[model samples]
Target: MALTLVTGGTGHLGRDIVDRLVRAGSRVRVLARTPGVRSNVEWAAGDLAAGAGLQDALHDVDTVIHAATFSPIARRGGIRPIDFFRSPSAVDVEGTERLLACAEKAGVRHFLHVSIVGLDEATLPYARVKLAGERLVRASALSWSIVRAMPFYYLLDRLLAGLSWLPVWPVPTTRFDPVDTSDVADHVVTCAFDGQRGVRTEIGGPEALDLVAFARQYQDARRLHRRILPIDLSETKARGMGFVASQGVRGHLTWTDWLRRNSPEA
Candidate 1:
């Protein structure tokens, strides 16, 4: 059946998007390497990197809410300095092109892409890969919308969790405005149905805080005590890479609120 196809449906943000779509009563399909068990949702087994199952996944689909990105560096705990230079050309780059082509062939009406902010200002290889994917979407023949969002609180939460054994919190500090995944999903669904095109203003949480502040709040919420030894990040305003949206609208949830709701210490 024709539906609103969501790429990366198994992911954190993609899962929320799919759930919201299903709850909103839009016929929904999800693209994943393994099929999902969500009721009323059709899961198409597909790998973006390999270009398999895209035709069947996109077939007769009129809208696409894409939240997929490839970053093995992230998957491996983001500690490798060398892996930072690696580009997601195969998945985000080539796979984006493949998806767009197949979607056009299926006569998809709107293609919504999810991206992080500061891709233009950041020199990171991951940013470049995401930019390349955005380019493919913009240049595609199908109608398109790109939603740039701030870093999620889960990112810092995970990073801190991985480093919880450290004696001191020695970390690079930078400005960040983390958003909730559900808020991003809501905005994505709204944009998907609004029928507008082109890149919209970035979206983030209510307040902007640096990495040190975020860490402190996290430690407090998790009932951990560690002295912060911060390294100053200079030269670029985009210190957290794409984590801060330069000028953007704010979502309702704040980092503290997210912590209060999700953290076990709460």
Candidate 2:
């Protein structure tokens, strides 16, 4: 059986990836900052930014899925927390480089990189780091594929539901092509099982919808009616949200569409 190592396997996407690997009968190991209890997965405790215990996890591993990334904490103006903005260089970018180097040493056959769509020109710090992570994977000697996809539906779904407590929800000016996190995980496992390389694929939801449209769909799905207040978005905020929206063309089934179909009211 091949040994697969996944970094940040406790996260939303990482959780899916780890579960998929285990179901496929592959021996799995995961590197996590906070080590806790998980059956069947060999957990190696380490921080990506600090670059410790990476060698232990990579040793004798056959494939690796790089899925860990830092999302925005709070964006106030142009600056953000140093850990959010600058740490990508340390964790996503440098940590990936370290993994590639160790993979080469360990004779790892393939490297699957998890990246976000529209990082090409995104103003957001997370998107920039994702792009940088892709660059590192591409330049490495290890065989690699950069899998880019739309934002996770759960991320948007929960955020809207959480904010619905307010009288009026302020929708972001941008839009999205939200994809299922499970689908992305399936694709990652496909890459691993097929040993595919030199291939770049973009995945997205079934359709496109602006932030307001998505929120309305959520309201309808939950059987709750609420007024949405749309205000002008700052240039940065608009671009940040728009980047994810741009990927909608590559994917289908806008978040609202999925909610409508899945909701009990449907």
Candidate 3:
């Protein structure tokens, strides 16, 4: 079988895809800045920003799951990147453009671009670029789909865990429908081969939760005695790159049900 190329294969969601593909016995090739190979898989070391080693890696693969992202940078007085950088336009727009051009040249069969729920690339710096990346993929001659999704549950779990260091849990007003990373990965693979072209789908967890509620419930379940303080979203610390900030709170999937099934306590 022809191999599937997964960018960011070592990342949370990307790792899920790699696991699924390997379990199904499909040939998998991952592009990494540092090559670390796994059995039944191939790793090509290069940088996507510089377009290094992309061609050599894309040689036999016809489908790509583009999951690589820049870690978000936050600054005071304004979003920090604005001083020394352009928003999503730089990486989401330009970086994706580079990938698309190369993928088109390589004759890839399908391109799957992952995006988030609320922020459109044009409006939110991060959202805008992701939106641009989708636009680029849509405009390409190759088959493509934009997977717009909500925050991943594991993301929230980690955040809550980190906040445990405080005397009390600080909750932001922002709501989240944290989708399971596995669900996202499943759909990613499905889109790659199911041949549903040019479709943009929004996915989320089984239920929505405000940060305070989520924190409180999680603490109760974990049997931790931490007071939960709710704060306004605007007052919350900014999440920088690779961090999933809440853009919207809903998805096709409900986070509540997913949480019940896979709570840290469970």
lDDT against the true structure, each candidate: 0.83, 0.74, 0.70
lDDT of candidate 2 over 1-266, digit per residue (tens): 77888987988788989999888788999999878698888888877788788888887888888887765432221233464345346777887777788788888888888887777667656667777878888888987877877777877766676676788787775656778777778877776667568646777877666678777778877977788888667656666543455332354345666676667656
Error of 2 at 258 (Å): 6.7
User: Which residues of candidate 1, in runs, are more than 4 Å off?
Assistant: 235-240
Which candidate number maximizes lDDT? 1
- How many residue pairs clash in all the candidates, one count each? 0, 8, 16
Query: Is candidate 1 or 2 superior in TM-score?
Result: 1
In model 3, what is the error at residue 71, expressed in angstroms? 2.6
lDDT of 3 by residue, 215-262 (tens): 777776556788777777442232322223344323354445555676
RMSD of each: 1.8, 4.2, 5.2
Off by over 4 Å in 3: 73-91, 121-124, 232-266
For candidate 3, give the lDDT of residue 180: 81
Per-residue lDDT tens digits for candidate 1, residues 1-266, read 34899998888899899889888888999999989777789889999999999999988898999898877655665556765576658888899999999988889989999998878776778888888898888888888999998777677678888778987988767677788888888888888998678898788878787878988988988888988899876647454355454477788888888989996745
Error (Å) of candidate 3 at residue 198 is 1.2
- Sort all candidates by lDDT, best to worst: 1, 2, 3
